[model samples]
Target: MKTILKNHRRKVTVYLGRRDFVDNSSTTEPIDGVVSITYRFGREEDEVMGINFSKEMQLVCREIPLKRDVKVTEMQERLLTKLGASAYPFSIDIPDNAPCSVQLFSDHSVKQ
Candidate 1:
């Protein structure tokens, strides 16, 4: 899901269905089901001493929907792959200390 971008700011919302499951991040078993995610980006921070913090920030994605057909950053992938338990929502806090970029794969693979 692509968050709508307004001007240079990203302020979009989405929803994922809820489900019941168990912890299996320790195994390779496919947690085959739906996941949820909600991402909110803060306004660009002012540059500091010729260093722009806006370009270097962390993103926290919560209630993000997951799918095997959806491939994300290695970190995100690892998180999803290692998620031990399932609940009403899937949340992830990404420390994107840089320009954040996210792409949702329809076929479940990261675009190369």
Candidate 2:
């Protein structure tokens, strides 16, 4: 799933669905599905200062459950189909001080 949030936004959106394997098997069951977000910051090197290093910190993590545990009523199925996707609705609050996604110093990366 891909989510885009403006600087003023405080929420993260996600889409959940079943993952099928190549053999027609499945990975995660929809009933116990969960969506998680991990916020991270890191640097590979500070070239101007001539420093070579790696550092990282995990600033936030959140997980939300899905509603597939119970059988979907006919009405619910119809509504979901009308939305045009089999994915479930999910969202999470972006915590205060959560860093914005960034990358620097070639080979470095940061994500929120």
Candidate 3:
């Protein structure tokens, strides 16, 4: 299994646009939105503090209704492509043994 330091933070990024937003494919000038999840994961013994971190992120999409399963699936597919099938099922995993921190960054900002 892969080993990572407990203090280290992992990043999961999803790029979305009108045409498509999955697998980090190329996009046009304007990107609809972007989402990033930061975390880490690995064996307890590998880490000095004995802990792991992880984050599961949904793929980018055209921003459809939440009730639409198709849209959700499409987005999920893209995320899986980046993270892999067994990486994350619904949420990221965090071990209780070690102290970890997760930080998220976004370019979108609101104007006062």
* Model 2, runs deviating above 4 Å: 1-59, 68-86, 104-112
Best by TM-score: 2
lDDT of 3 by residue, 8-103 (tens): 233544444243223323322322222345555655453464343244343322433223133233444565466543333232222233223334
Runs of candidate 3 with Cα error greater than 4 angstroms are 1-12, 17-36, 41-76, 85-112
Candidate-wise lDDT, in order: 0.34, 0.36, 0.35
lDDT of 2 by residue, 13-55 (tens): 2323322312213222222222333343564243345433255
Tell me the tens digit of each residue's lDDT in model 1 across 1-112. Answer: 2222222222332222222223344432222222323345665553332422222233443444433555454443444454433312233432324232333444334344
Best-to-worst lDDT order: 2, 3, 1
Alpha-carbon runs more than 4 Å astray in model 1: 1-63, 85-112
- How far in Å is the alpha carbon of 70 misplaced in model 3? 5.0
Residue 100: error of model 3 in Å? 39
Q: Residue 110: error of model 3 in Å?
A: 20
Best by lDDT: 2
Error of 2 at 18 (Å): 23
